[model samples]
Target: SQITIPILSGDEVNAILILETNQEPRFSLSDWDFARRLAENAGIAISNAQLYAELTRADESKSEFMAFAAHELKNPLTPIKGYAEMMLKGATGELTDQQKQIMHVLRTNAERMQTIINDLRDIARMDARQFRIELSPIDIYNVVIETLRPFMQQLEEKGQTIVNNVPEGLPLIIGDATRLIQVMTNLVSNAYKYSPPGSTITITARPETSYRTPNGNLHKNVMYISVADNGIGMSEEDLQKIFRERYFRSSNRAAQDQPGTGLGMMITQHIIELHNGEIWVESKLGEGSNFQFVIPLAVEEGGDTPETSPDAATEPASD
Candidate 1:
């Protein structure tokens, strides 16, 4: 005699267990019950394993498509940007006032597109563990000033005021100047996006005795910097999703209408981690938001701090 148990997962029989033995009585009631229970669990495990395998394959395909699409889009943006710049500069011919204004808008958006493409590539490289940063002594205040300079006209248009509270005597920290500038630019731009006209944005910095790294390790002697704005703050839900999802825009109607790729904070977080530092945020729905990050201070030497090595330097920005 034979006893068989059909393993059902969801609405489908995924497998079965069969007991075959030449015995007086083939199986007892208790034996049948135990076999059925074991078969059901086995069916669930098999179904889950198959589902996980499918998901992994899908994720890999998505990554490949993203990398390829970004590369193809980036190649043409450079030439498009160049032509737009030349037209704005009268390289093709002298343009009327109206033509110049149109060309300026075109050029500006082209640059923005290039930035988006670069961000996409950065994200893909980061996933592949190809992203890197060259650590060096950086003057945070100067980087902030320079990064904010380009937005002066926009600030004026919005009637926004910026307060730079970075002290003059702040110590240089070990970090990549360009990436740090990128971080500041993103935070400031985000502030500008959600804040109303005439709002105030502040940048502040201070020295820290010790800081915690992402890996739960503690290190001494770091610098803390923050960008704060009296903008439309995010809810706890939005705050949680910001760093986790790429191209995630806030559910706030105001923020949704604003222009952004949403990869900035994620890239900023990665850069901070590469420097063995931490990044965080604080906000309330009705009040405002503060984005903060910390980087290690340059090692003290007798005369001058040694320059950081260029090995594993940040990958070149996609064209």
Candidate 2:
């Protein structure tokens, strides 16, 4: 006698298991049941393994393509920017007020394109495990101030108030200055983008008695930095998906008018994790949102290192 069993992957039958035995009863009912269970589990395991391999290959291909495309796009930006600047400066020729304004817009947009290209390059580096952070002792408060400075004009134009509550004499933490500034800038930008005019964005810093690491270890002497906004708060679902997914947009009315690629928070989270820190958010639907992260006050000497390559590649290429 022969026994046949369907092996399923998802809802489809991926294969079949067959058993033929010559015994007194060939196979008992109990034995057949056991065999079915084993075969079903094996089918699921095999399906998962196959899917993983396929996804891995596709991700590698995507990374290579992104790196190539980002590099190609970056090459032409220099001339575009230079020409726009030259025209604005009258290096090409004198221009009327209207022409000057148009040239200014061209230059500004070119700069924004350059920034997007740079971000793409960073994403490629992250996929390739080439994204590096130079760590050193730095004043976190100063970084926050500098990051907020450029946005002052925009905030003022919108009638928004920025209150910097980061106090002086905060313990210097080991961090990648540029990356930390980028994180702060991203958070502050989100606050500015989502909040209505006349709303206040507050930057606060304090000492955390205990900070938890990603690996479930808690460290002492931690510094906490937060950016809070009284803008349209996100739903619980949005908050849960924000950092974990790419190109996630909020359904809030305040955010609907804002233009963003939605990659900022994703990049921000990776940067904090690179510093061996953790990030989180607190929000209510009708209230507001507070975004925060913590880093060790003092890193152990010689322990400065980037995250593992496999870990860095986990995030998709920045869009």
Query: What RMSD does each model have against the real structure?
Result: 5.8, 8.3
Local accuracy by lDDT, each model? 0.82, 0.81
Each prediction's TM-score against the native? 0.79, 0.73
Question: By TM-score, how accurate is candidate 2?
Answer: 0.73
Which stretch of 10 consecutive residues in model 2 shows the poorest summed lDDT?
Answer: 305-314
Candidate 1 residue-wise lDDT, 5-81, digit = tens: 88877889887789877977767888888888899899999889989999988877776777888899988888988
Alpha-carbon deviation at 79 in model 2, angstroms: 3.6
Give the poorly placed runs of model 1, Cα more than 4 Å off. 1-27, 126-130, 167-169, 211-219, 284-287, 301-319
Winning candidate number (lDDT) = 1
Tens digit of per-residue lDDT, candidate 2, span 1-319 = 7888999888888888999977677788888898899888988898999999999899888888878888898888889889988887889788999999898788778777776776676777787888899888777767876788778778988999988897656667878989999999889988888888899999998777677745476867778899999988889888888998877788776676776767778889989989988898888886778998888675445754222112323323211
Worst 10 residues of 1 by lDDT: 310-319
